[model samples]
Target: MLDPRFLTIPITHRGLHAPGVPENSLAAARAAIEAGYGIECDIQPGPDGEPLVFHDYQLHRLTGAQGFIAATDAATLAGLRLLGTDEPVPTLRQFLDLIAGRVPLLIEIKDQDGACGPNVGTLPARVAEALAGYDGPVAVMSFNPHMIAAFREAAPHVPVGLTTCAFGEDDWARVPPARRDELAAIADYDAVGASFISHDKDDLDNPRVDALRAAGAGILSWTIRSLAEEQAARRIAQNVTFEGYRAAY
Candidate 1:
């Protein structure tokens, strides 16, 4: 049932790892390349409206900085070190250059809970611009269906997908009840024109995912942290967007 075009190869979530290379750092990307695995990274809008390769909404966890990632300009971000390491945050352009067509790159565009703030409205376009001349296999995805649609229009040649999970109690405060239900049910698949569905590993049993795969849509699962998890993912989803340990194919 897996879509061979994508899951045929292995993928590393936030790239390969080491003691020094933090997640989403350029060093992590290089580590993934050296290890011969497909690369995956998170993208967010920078203060200057450019797309930067970062994972969190805030910089405190990774950079020791005390502000939102959208609050700083790309130049300022380039100057700050990640996790106290000498390695600085790299832009999407820099990330693509490093990959250089050697392996496929999957980009997850981070969303701000459907709230348009700062440069958030223009993120899909900026990311498309960054991927313009890159000669490689690249794809974009987001939890926000609207953003996914935007990317489809902006870069029809590049495959776009929807990354989703079944919402539960913990998400109620942040997400509206009706909206949560819609996402949990994947109610926007056809409307968004998603080329793939990156469902949460725990929610892969959803019948909708199975339906999509039956229809020839790619199904990729995320954050697989162990061999056991990888094995489980293979039985259902096409690929594993993994981390915490190297994925052994």
Candidate 2:
């Protein structure tokens, strides 16, 4: 089941990021807690199967580094600084310890297959192990349904969901057209046992989302940047994953 707190709490995308406090950093997580907002973060397995709190598969944009996150070892990742900040990337465990259940957490596990297809790697078990004893209001989701299925098998008790979108060609050049269309229809919702969906704020009007909402599924929206956007997204979504500004609900 989807966690009820995720529905009621206002979520901060990437942990209330701001100047000098980069997204997914421990500093950002602390900022979100101080602001009394739920945290939404992303996770990728380190080189040795440890889960790191990070967003891109690539390291350059956030860290000014040269390679993918899966190629970097735990200690190395801990050493690299976030752009304009001294804060290093944190492990999933460190993030959880800091939060300590003070606020809800939503973790998005980026697709490992690169194609968002069936070739999911060992991330499922690694992530499941990380969440094994950590008590918090947390949910896991991905744009790839296959990853969600694998994760569900590994951690059945955790609420799992899909990160939905209209999958515009320009925006999703990595995901093939066929897969994009296939996922856009949301055909895997039941087969993968998803209890919720964090859809693109622009596409919440889709019939599939409405159908699921009518059937009692949890509906969340992503990247709401302002109070106006949050207000509009609340019409369809029970909550929002937001950034660039505080959501004043």
Candidate 3:
């Protein structure tokens, strides 16, 4: 089972982020911490396998830079600014130190393979290493089950989860239809040793989600942006990972 705080606390999606505060940036993380909310952020591995607090594999959207994060070195990543702000990408090391066990943290390790096949690389191990001795209600999950499995092997004590979704083509264009069907079914939840799921909020009606809940899996949902949305999500999910607007209990 996951730490109960993850179920009860209102988690800020990519940390209470708004227009000026880019998602996954330290600014957003601090805002969430100051607001007394749990924080959820995504991490991508830099060249040295150190995890950077970021969502996109490509640097363009957040940093206005060229190339995928995998291709960039730590020195260069440390220099690139986020969303035209003064904040450079923060390492998992920097992030953990800043948080210092103040609030719960949920980390989503970005899938290394676009198709979610294998190719998980060292990101999971690196993330677990970064979280070593970190005292808090912290958990890690990934869209890629292989990544979760890897982290499970490396840090069995840390709570592990799956980032579930309906896997629609509009959003998951790179994943094949067969793979999409499998992911939507959450076929790997048990195999990866997942204790919880952050599912697509709109798809909570899927009976499999209910089945998992009935079987004692912790139910959570993502990207809720309004009070009405939060209320509806909480009807199915015990807690929410949200952004854009404030989430009310």
Model 3 worst lDDT window (10 residues): 240-249
The TM-score between candidate 2 and the true structure equals 0.96
Measured against the true structure, the TM-scores of the candidates, in listed sequence, are 0.93, 0.96, 0.96
What ranges in model 2 sit over 4 Å off? none
Q: After superposition, how far is residue 34 of candidate 1 from its true place, in Å?
A: 1.2
Instruction: Identify the superior model by lDDT, candidate 1 or candidate 3.
Output: 3
Candidate 2 per-residue lDDT, tens place, 172-226, comes to 7888898889888888899989999999999989999999999999999998988
lDDT of each: 0.81, 0.90, 0.90
List pairs with backbone clashes in candidate 2.
Answer: none
Which clashing pairs does model 3 show? none
TM for candidate 3 is 0.96
Which sequence of candidate numbers ranks them by TM-score, best first? 3, 2, 1
The runs of at least 3 residues in candidate 1 whose Cα sits more than 4 Å from the true structure, single-residue gaps closed, are 1-5, 113-120
